[model samples]
Target: MSSQPEQTMETQQQKKKKWEMPDTYVILFSVLLLAVIATYIVPSGSFDREMMDGVERVIPGTYSGVEGNATGFMDIFLALQEGMVQSAGLIFLVLFAGGAFEIVERSGAIKGGILRAVSKTRGKEFWLIATVSVLFALGGAVGAVANSVIPFVAIGVIIARALKLDAIVAVAITFGATFAGFNVGFLNPYTVGIAQSIADIPLFSGMLLRVIAFVVIVSVTILYTWIYAKRVLRDPSKSLVGVLDESQASKEDLRAPFTARHKFILSFVGLSLLFFIFATIQFKWTINHMAAFFIIIGLVSGVIAGMNYNKVAITFLEGCQKLVYGALIIGVARAILIVMENAKILDTAVNALSVPLEGLSPVFAALGMFVANGLLNFLVPSGSGQAMIAMPILTPLADMVGITRQVAVQAYQFGDGFTNSIFPTSGPLMASLAVAGVPWIKWAKWMLPLLLIWVVIAVIMLTIGVLINWGPV
Candidate 1:
């Protein structure tokens, strides 16, 4: 009788129609097609620029239409190559970083570490969720790109399963938390650092308010993720990624004492991170710089983990190969912006968007600023890139609307950071989701409500900044 019922349940599961999600490329290309259509309808325009704060700034009132280089069908293919070239640095970082992490994985250090983490958190898994989320969140706040912490999502999955939670909880604690901190980045060099520089504020100035934003954002992530994890633990059917698989962290071998090789791998990773941080601040290291750093560290880690040169090379290539699909999307996503830039409508959109806030009060102006940047982030997903374009326009506009430049930067930060988590155009989000094996539609279903909550928090935070007349240090 038991076998018969089990067979029936298995039959039922097999008969159930599974959801087939569209590929990330299909979604991105579909959007790219829409962007091509947009070029025909939207008038092309340009602005005269003058250098301000050591970077080019668009003079607020100098917008004019020009003959558009209308984007055609052939242009779409051209945009792809151009986008790849334009985003080569970021794409290479993803490839190299993937290889670097693959080396870590092959060493069994991460697996060993996860085993220890799972063992330690056996009875206190809820706090484990909070602890891990906060750590990834801080990474975003402290100059890490939201996607930079994505390599850890695999670890998160292993830990979540050992605790009997689902993949949503796995990603929520890692990618989700990192993005939350990315959104509320108090000291984020890419978002906060760039915007502050353009806004003429001292570096790391206005940090106290950002600290509060960080707490609000990260706390909400912890609470929401824990609640969801508990709900799934109680009722497995409610999981977004239904039917959990047993994790490797549960195997008997994982419970053994860490080998000296694994221990050295861990120590080396910590030391590498410390040096990376120092190098970033002291040398103004870019993502490419960090990518090279990872390559070196990965090799050292591989040797320490007992892998010979050939094995390390093979493992590194395998890692990079795994990430190729995700990494390629980075370039594809960049094509949308390249298309707009070529058509010359990029400036037109910026100009048109700013027109509404010309005479609004600071409260509404600040609110509008946030919304505008959120909309614009779809077209230009890069943090520093968005800062480069939007900050220049919004800065002078903030002055005209009687809003503070610091508040403007806050709006830009929230707008650019929050949307990347949900936007289809965000390559890193999609790549991370692919790596997690959680589909975008499912991820969206889980993440959309949190994004709405973020918008509410953004409103409250921006309102406070406006009322306090938040100023530079």
Candidate 2:
């Protein structure tokens, strides 16, 4: 009787896995196939007429643009190649950061620092989570390099567990806090710089205002994360309510007898911050993205922590290896962008999307920007890339509807940052998911409520940006 109840309970508890592998694969493949057709094979008259007679073809009426002899298969293949080429720099950047983190971790620098830091924090989970969130929020300045915050997350989870708190709650707070900073990214070089530049704003020219806005967003996000973390700690079963797994992280390897190693790591990080602050203040040398800078810090930290040359080299190499899978996924995802660009699918998508809102008032233009940026995020995963592509289009469109270019840029930045932590196709996002071993569906489920919160916040922020007429003329 006892055994029967146990078996029945087990069977009942196992909900059918919602997102099946085959279904996901099929859906992805179908989307890729459609993107290809839309770009290369779609018989558009504009493409045909423009290529043959060059009459400033705004839209392709026929996609037979290359020549009469070019096959549809060859066209799609070329589009894919073009995408890979364009995304090369971005892919390299991601791999570099991953390698650098590997060096820091393998060198025992990260672990040593974590042990010392966690022990010091002790039972102050609230303070610890808040501080970590602030650190990660600065990640936007570095671009996606903020992903290095994963170690902080692991440490936070471990600390929470030691305090008898639910592990998932800790992970959620840590991850959410990091992303909160990432989302606001007051000084994000890739996002803020690109958007401002597109609207002709001097680089970091209005940083004070952005910093204030960023602080507000990050503060609120951290507070909410802390609140949620406490609730889960109070009820372990509820931990997974807005979280992925209660025990996704296996026990981490902690080095014992932490001594001077902690001091070394802190010194390295402290010096790095000093260098950046000095550069930004005195020399006016602005890093294009903060992500790259942090990776460099990690590398330098490893070397200073006594990791041998060979070990450092191998550790960096291992990080590079770790990025390969994510990179491949990126490559596949870029194929979609490639086809879209070659076929001018974005132009078509934008045209169709903008049609309904064309006659709407100036206020609606801001709304349009928000919707467009969010949709474009799905197609172009990189913040800088999307800004480069979308800003050029949105700037002109916004002007036509009495909206300022600055408001458009703000709209783009808000959409780009908000989605980075959740988008399945985002390379770093997948990397985080892989390390955490939380399925994408599970992460999405946990984030849906949070996403709603962010969306509402973003709408309000963008409205403020528009009301204040944010950005350069």
Candidate 3:
């Protein structure tokens, strides 16, 4: 009897431990704590910055030691305030986009359109994956489509179920494809544009190479996703989330027919996105403009869907409420950067990393930069923010080492974009997983194989980039 009781107690303890993964907030704050410790250990430094054509450009060879301002425990809370202030535009963008998408979703337009697409692609699931993934890739390549795709996770999951596939396949097809296109982006203004501007290179200068990369990477992603999707489709029990699959099955098919109203709503969103891109390129629109655009689109979309103003208000608030976690995550993630900036060790860390590249050959230099940027992405997940911090240091280092600034940008693109799909600190990735009801640990497991394959491909691309002297040096 004593042994039986001990065995039962041991089993319960094991079960409790099995389900334990640190909460997202805990992980982020823990990183904050480490940043505090780093302030004491790492030297403080900075680069001389100047305004060139209205953008702050870091002058090369200007790094120097600065007085250390190590953060105390009390400063951590103040850093949170600074982080929110810095990330306010991004936070509002998330809120507005979430609200607008919610309005469109309430119109049954997205669901109706998705159902129709699924019906048309029935029995040719591979093609469905290809088509959906490509469209998503195009959006990510040309526009700010990462957060935009969050609303589509439900639609993708629905398609997965209708086709007898699993939620992992749904996430891979949607988030995975977007990430591939983003990393290999031919014209991603958020990453490529910002990096190029910071590097003082002509915007979108090395297009052909990036276009080729985008095609190759996205093709590989589609193929990889389709293979796993096929396996799960063949035997549902083979799914990583097999137990959850059963619960997902009984979800009601709420898909309606794509009506004229739905078409109008989608067209409005599509046109608004086109305007966003044009304004961004021609008029230098920022995140604030994007946020306002989303708010306008939400209100207009609600009116177009024949909703009363009160209903629209309620729906928009509800949508924002749903994504509060995601929006807060943007600010919280920024807190890490705040801590680093205040400590003045960000430049010191960059300088230390760059020291080894001084003697590296061109190809090795490019690869080293790529690896460094990937590691840095863990600290600063925001594309524009990472560009601001890293490109300043890496650009000068690239020229010193015979690597083109364009190649430096390419390395940053690959490093910054690909990691978002896997990193726990990625607000959008974590939010999408939560929306899909997949655990972060489970997503990590399913994503590791693909991540490894992409890393290999990234190495090859960086090698080719260096070999050809991918330029505008």
Off by over 4 Å in 1: 1-22, 135-216, 225-260, 361-366, 369-453, 460-473
Residue 28 alpha-carbon offset, candidate 3, angstroms: 3.2
TM-score of 3: 0.75
RMSDs, each prediction? 7.6, 7.7, 5.2
Per-residue lDDT of model 3, residues 1-473, tens digit only: 69999999999988785554465567678878888899999889987877756545456578899987889888999888887787676667667777887898799876676667666777898988888788678767854466667777777777777677777877877777788888876656556765776676665667778888889888988998888888877787778886234445544663467999999998998898777756766776666676788899999999999999999999999988876765676566677777888888877766676678767888999988888889888866766567655776687677557777888998998889888999987877987898788888999998888888888888898899889878752
Question: Which regions of candidate 2 deviate over 4 angstroms?
Answer: 1-32, 39-71, 108-115, 139-154, 186-210, 229-299, 325-348, 361-363, 372-413, 416-449
The window of 10 residues in a row where model 2 has the poorest summed lDDT is 46-55
Poorly placed runs, candidate 3 (over 4 Å): 1-19, 50-54, 135-171, 182-212, 227-255, 373-413, 419-453, 460-473
- For all candidates in order, the CA lDDT equals 0.78, 0.60, 0.77
Evaluated against the true structure, the overall lDDT of model 2 is: 0.60
TM-score of 1: 0.68
Residue 160 displacement (Å), model 1? 6.2
lDDT of 1 by residue, 208-324 (tens): 899998999899989988888888888998898974577445565326456778888877876877676567556766666766877897799888877889999999888789767
